[model samples]
Target: SAENVYKADGTIAKSGKLKTGFTAVIDSRTYVIAVCGDVTGEGNVNSKDVTLLQKYLCDNAELDGAYLKAADFNLDGEADNRDLVLISRQKN
Candidate 1:
C-alpha cells in the first residue's frame, strides 16, 4: 500500500520526506526528472502555492494536503525548491 504523509488541505504532522524516488517509464527512454511539482496544479507556477512551500520550509510548518501533491517542488517527496531555481532567479 502507498504511505500517507499529510491531509487533504495542507496540515503536515510528520517530520520526514516521503518516498517519491522513481524513474517514470517513457517509451524507448527513461525520464529522469519529469516529476510534476505544480503542487496545486494551478499551472504556470506562481506565488499562491510557492507561499505554502515557503511556509513549510521557513516557518517550519506543514500543508494539510499530500506532500507529493503540494509542497514537493521536485517531486522527490520533499518540500524543497531545487527545481525552483528559476522562481528565485527571476527579478521581483
Candidate 2:
C-alpha cells in the first residue's frame, strides 16, 4: 500500500527535501526521517528542538525514528541527559 507523506502534526508533508524531524506516514507506520538535530521538524536545528527534547526526557513528549536518532547528539546509542546537553549546545 501507498500513502502520502505526513508531518508529525498529521498534515501532508510539503514537497521538498526531507530534513530531520520532518515526519512521514507510510504503510500504516509513522517515522521521522533524515538529518540530525532538527527534532522539531522545522527543517533547521534550533532552541525549539532542544525544548522538545527536554520534554521528551521528562516524559512530557514523544520522539521516534529519526527524531530519536537526532536527539542522540553524542551517538551513544541512546538519548539521555548527555545528548540533551549536546543538543542544547548546538541549537541556533
lDDT of 2 at 21: 52
lDDT string for model 2 (1-92, tens) is: 33666665667765876677556667888665756677776777789988999999999999888778888878878889988888788878
Count of backbone clashes, every candidate in sequence? 5, 0
Where model 1 places Cα greater than 4 Å from the true spot, the runs are 1-35, 40-44, 83-92
* Best by the TM-score measure: 2
lDDT of 1: 0.43
Computed on alpha carbons, the lDDT of every model, listed in order, comes to 0.43, 0.77
TM-score of 2: 0.66
